[model samples]
Target: MKTDVEELTPTRVKLTVEVPFDELKPNLDKAYKEISQQVRIKGFRPGKVPAPLIDKYVGRGAVLQEAVNDALPELYGRAVEETEIFVLGQPDVEVTELDDGNQFAFTAEVDIRPKFEVPDYDGLEVVVDDAEVTDEQVDETIGNLRERFASLTTAERPVEDGDFATIDLVARIGGEEIEDASTSGYSYEVGSKSAIEGLDDALVGLSAGEEKTFTGTLVGGERAGEEAEITVTVQSVKVKNLPELDDEFAQLASEFDTIDELRDDVRARLGRQVKLQQLSEARDKALEALLEKIDIPLPDKVVEEEISRRNQQLEQQLQMAGMSKEDYLKDEEKSEEEFDKDVADAARLAVKGGFVLDQLAVQEELGVENEELSEYVVTQAMQMGVQPQQLAEYLTQNNQLPAIVSEVLRSKALNLVVEHVTVKDESGNEIDVDAVQRELNGETGETVAADDTDAADEAGVDEADTAEVDTAEAAEAAEPAEAAADAPAATAETAADEAPAAEPKNEGAKDA
Candidate 1:
């Protein structure tokens, strides 16, 4: 077997492979066996028919096709391994030679990872917002907890902000009543700004039994866009009486026996929340730093495929939502040109980030351990609300395990970068993400370094990588003769590889 590669672009390549007849003999034999199982020959048992007779019956071309089909994947994979190209998706294969007992030659063209130098990331500084829990913030947290223990008391005074109003309503569009648009005995919090527009204002000054009428657009149903005149009657107004802040109240609300103790606990909780936020900020900032510092050429075909996939996904979602692209654009306040350009730009950022991380994974010699893969599977399973076994089966059955492993490795690579970056708070004090995480988890040593490899990292991938064809389908082009020969033959189809979660880290001011 001989293989040679041609560099088509920084992100793509054309591979020409030559397989000698000796190497293909095994596949040819396998193909005969496979075909023998299917075709019935007179005076020969099914699957027991000899190769030559069957070939005479089914044609020499048919048997040759079967051999080529079974051989393509192995040949393609071998070529890829030898070339060491970071393939983004599937390859386009063309068989140029099929001389029996002589040689088989084919060409495979594919998108490869872009070549780029990772910028020096050590001590790459990013300022994050202050994570300090202020006294006012503690007070607000305690107040929210207090609200949970609050009791509603009927008030003698008029409706006001913070008052819960029990109300009734009638909606009429052009003096005609809209049935579903009206409700009675509904409990609404004044100044909450929920429900119909202007309803809060209409109820603010109304007393019990006082009615106010206002016009607002209907949100749904037959008269969805029509303006409706709503008449709201306040049945009663009640204010929430929060529990007193004292020892007894503290004991009732939490395990703490004193208000001071409760305040301390609230402050600690707030601190942890902010610490999580800061950790997230640091990770985002680290990735942003890398993306900005490094330069990579985006593969045009890969980008176009990504954009197409996402657009298809979007179209599918819009269809499910009973909307068209035009309707969706109108709803989102975007023009077709703007939406397309945005898609292209976003695709570039994503593909570039992927290339960078993939290179980093290579540089660090990162490998996805079984434990890491198991953890990733568990996490993904939880998110999808399925059992681990079920998710594992699906992923394995679809040959998606490699893609999952890649996802896990990239996460580790991202974490590796973040480990070297300097993350500081707004106060010019360095933010020690590891130390905080250790404190929060009640563990010691280098734990926070692993925080960035979370699935939450992939939150904003609504329009990413939808253009990836099934792995089986992608490989099919390389071995089409075999595919046509099989009658409902089962072949593994690899699912689209998901992008490892990443984003800009410093959207807000540096954390303190």
Candidate 2:
């Protein structure tokens, strides 16, 4: 057997392989055995029929076809290995030559990873906002906490701002009632400014049983931008009764005994959350900047495949939402051509980013640790309101765990770059690494070491126990003779932190 390789592009290769008659004989014999088992001769037992007898009955062409089918994958794999091509997708195999006692020749075209020089990432300067937790922010956080525990009470007066109202609404175009423009006993909040322009104003000053008519344009829906006469009849009004911000209220609302303690805790939590958001944004900016400096040509086939997958997923999502493709496109304000153009750009970005991150991971020798992956999976499961084992089963059933691991590793590589980079503020001042990390992790402006004993204790897990389950599984699968071989590694925790481990089922729900 022999193989020749030709470079078609930076990320594509064409391989021509030739298998001599000696190499083809084994496949021919195996093919004959397989076919002999499927056919029944008058006096011959199943699979006991001779090759020549089966060939005489089934035709020589059928035998050759079966042999070729069985041999293609093995031959292609050998050719790929011999040529040292890191194929990305399934190859397009074309048999070029096949003759009796001669040579079996074929060509395979495939996409491969493009080799390129990585830019210097260490000490790369990036800008991030200074972590600043203000009194106003703390106050807002407290107000939100209070709102969460607020009680709704019926009111006997006209609807006002911040008050909830039950109303009957009817929309008409040129005084003709629209078929889908009426709702009874719809509960709306005055000043929410969500339903339509002038809706809140119309609800205000209207008591129960009072009716008012107004005109507004449908901001969305089939008749978007069309003016419609709307009649609103107020059925009831209600107001939220907020608890007092006192020690007694704190006792009822949380485990804290006093309002001061609750307020302090809320402030700390809010500060940490804000810091985490800033860190995430900063990391994104830094990554985007670094990618801009790098040159990576994505394989066309990879981009096309990704685009097809994304489009399919989008179609599935639309169908599940009881929406047609046309309706979805209309809602996005895009034509088919426009949507395709956007999808192409997105696919290119995805492929390029993946390639660049993978290269970086290789260069940095960064990997996902066992404990980190386990912790990640466990954390994700908890967030999804499922047990860790359940989440694992779900991921396995969906065959998404590997993809998740890949994503995790990519993020870890990015974090490695970020760790060495110099982050500055708008004023050109070097940002404090501890302060930035606190903001990024939403750690209440507190800088804690990754191996913080107190945090581990709080989480009910010691450092050793945190090893990722996937890594452990891999190690157990390794044989003693092959134990010396490098074991499979789990995905990085930082990557898991950046993206939700599992895709969210509902946009409104917290990610797992």
Candidate 3:
């Protein structure tokens, strides 16, 4: 057997195989035996008929067809192995030559892995923002917490801001009642902007038992852009009463016994959340900067595949939302051609980014440890409110476990990259890495005692001084995790290629 491969594209190849009569003889003999058992013969017992006798009885054409049918798969398999083609899917084969007592030849076309070099990734310069937690951020979080614990009480005056009012409403278009246009005793908040435009203003001065009417354009309902007459009758008014920010209130609101303790907890939580956001932003900036510096050529087929998948996802989402593809195009202010063009550009960027990251992972020898993957699975299960075993079962059933594991490994690799990079703030100052991490964990000013206002102020100054360093570290920590989450997992074949064949890199594989 002889095999020849032709380059169709960077990621596609066509293999042509030529088999001589010697290689085809075994399959021919097997085919004769199989066909002999299935046919009826007048003078011979079943499975006892000779090939020459059967040929004379069944005709040469019928025997040759059976022989060819049995030989094709073995020929194809040999062609794949001899050519060393890493096929992505099933091959399309066409027989070019098959004559009696002559060479048998066929051509198989397929998509194969492209050969490419990993780009240089070491000592690449990337700048990240400072992950600092601020007092204002803490206050905002505290305010939100207070609102969550606020109580509502009946009010004896006209409706006002933050006041909930129960009312009967009727809407009419062009002096005619529209379908599903009326509701009784619907509760609404004045100045809370909960109702359609002009409705709040229409109810502002109305007391219980008072009725009023207003007109406005429907902003975004089924009747969007249509002018409608709205009549509302105020039935009752209620106002929210927030508890005073006192020690007793703090004890009631949380596990803390004092207002100071609650304030500290809120400040810590806010700081951590802000730190995480800062880290995320810094990582994105670093990645963008790195991508700008590197010019990578991506396969067109990869981009097209990504775009097709994206469009399918978009269509599914639209359908779930009770919208049509045409409706989405209108909402996006685009034609199908325009949408495709935009998606194609995005797909190209996505493919390039994946290639770059994979190269970096390889160059850096970044990998996920088995323990880390197990921890990730546990964390994800907790977030989803399910048992770890249940989550594992679901992933396995869906054939997604390997993909998930790869994602975890990719994240670990990115984090390794971040750890080695230097980070500077906007002011060219170095930041404290540990403090930044704590902030990202949402524990900013919590360590400072409530009475130690001076220490808190000092910490803030230190945070500013060390902003750059922290930003860099946070970027290093966050980039891989975010990238891993966003990236699509490799298929089984790709994952197999990625995994070390001689020595397993992860504990999961070792266990398996």
Candidate 4:
């Protein structure tokens, strides 16, 4: 058996394989045995029928065809391993020559990782904002805490900002009542600016038992973007009574006994969050700098699929949120053209980043150990709101473990890049990314070693939000893996970040 690779493009190849008759003998035998069990001969037992007898009953062509189909995947995998070509999508397998007991020749054309030189990853400088927690932010945090403990008291005055109103609403579009546009006894905060457009403006100055009719356009439901006359009746108005920010309030709100102590704790928490933001900034900026330093030619087919997958996922989210695409576009303040461009750019960058890191992982000979995979599973399970066992079972059941392992490898590759790059804050002070990560992980407090500064804990960097729905298909989740023909693309974001790990399910490897 032999295989030769023909380069069709920078990102695709054709494998011409020649297998002599002896190489296919095992597959032929297996096919004969399978067909033997399915057919019943007058005197022959189900599993005891001979190969020649079975072939005489079932045409030799039929057995050969089944054998070829069963062997294509294994043959293609062998070709990939022999050439060390990173295949993207499934191959287009064609049996060019098939003569039983003589020769079997086939061709598989597949998308592959384009070969490119990696730019120097060392000394790449990335600048991040200073990790400064502001007094105003702390005050806001405390105010939010106070709001949680606040009590509501009936107010006998006109509805005002900062007051809560229990109201009933009915919406009619062009005089016909709209379904899903009516709710009773809904509690709303006047200044919260939630629920409907122009709701707060209409509610203000309307006293208890008073009714107001306003013209507005419904943003959701069958009447989305349709002009509607809404009538809102305020059944009762109540004002929030916040507890005083004294020592008593501190004890009630938190474990701290003193107001000053609670404030200090909040400030400390803010400081930690600030550190996390610094880490995220460094990561994004570093990746951007790395991308700018080199040019990567991404495959059009892969990029197009990525864009399509993202659009589909976005549509799903919009449906779940009861929003139309037009409404979403308006809310995001983007035109259709602009949104398309952004998706394209993001998709390209994503693929480029993955390709670069995969190359690094290979060059560095980085391998994902059981320890690393276990740690990642535990961390990812926590983020996905599932037990580690449950998440593992889902991945294993769906054949997604390959994707998860690839994600981990890519993350370590990125971390390796970070180790070589120079990172600093806006003030020109060198930023210790790993140290900041350690603080978040509660690994150390007093001092961090040099290695710790480089091996930034990959967990706790919340740059991307991932929702790991235990769905069977990844096409329904987020972006599918790169032109992953037989395996998933390396999608590790290093921080074991919330990534779309459920890769798309496709087994065929064919060409365009």
lDDT of 2 at 111: 78
- Winner on TM-score between 1 and 3 is 1
lDDT digits (tens) for residues 101-166 of candidate 1: 899999999877666667778868899989888999998878777766777778888999978888
Each model's backbone clash number: 16, 12, 9, 12
Error in Å for residue 435 of model 4: 3.2
lDDT of 2: 0.68
Candidate 1 global CA lDDT score: 0.71
lDDT, candidate 2, residue 303? 71
lDDT of 4 at 187: 79
TM-score leader: 4
Question: What lDDT tens digits, residue by residue, belong to model 3 across residues 1-512?
Answer: 88999998766788888888677788778878887888888888777889888878887678777887788887887776677554544567888888767788889887554555544445655555555667787777666667667666778998887677878987889787755666897767677564578888888888999989898775545776688898989988887666688998888779999989998988765555544555544444445555676765555655667777767777666656655666567766889998888777766655555555555665665755555555555545544656666776676577555456545555544455455555566667654444565543344433322112223333222333221111122223433323333346332112211111122111111100
- For each candidate, give its TM-score against the true structure: 0.75, 0.76, 0.67, 0.85
Segments in model 2 whose C-alpha atoms lie over 4 Å from true places: 170-181, 196-198, 213-230, 307-347, 365-369, 394-405, 427-512
Runs in model 3 deviating more than 4 A are: 1-3, 17-114, 174-181, 216-227, 308-346, 362-369, 431-512
Model 4 regions lying over 4 Å from their true place: 173-175, 443-512
Cα lDDT, model 4, residue 74: 84
lDDT of 2 at 166: 79
lDDT of 2 by residue, 314-334 (tens): 777765665567767776788
RMSD, each candidate, Å? Answer: 9.9, 6.9, 12.9, 9.4
Q: Write the per-residue lDDT of candidate 4 for residues 1-512, one digit (tens) a residue.
A: 79999999889899999988788777888898889889999899997888888778888899999899888888877888888887886678899999878999999998888887677888899888898989899999999888677777888999999788889999997788887988899878887765788898999999888899998878678667788999999998888777899999999989999999999988987776677667666766676787788786677888787777667777777776666777677777989998898777777777777777777666776766665655566666655667676887787787776676567666676777777778898889998777666666674332222222232322442324323333333322322233233343324332121122222211111111
Computed on alpha carbons, the lDDT of every model, listed in order, comes to 0.71, 0.68, 0.62, 0.73
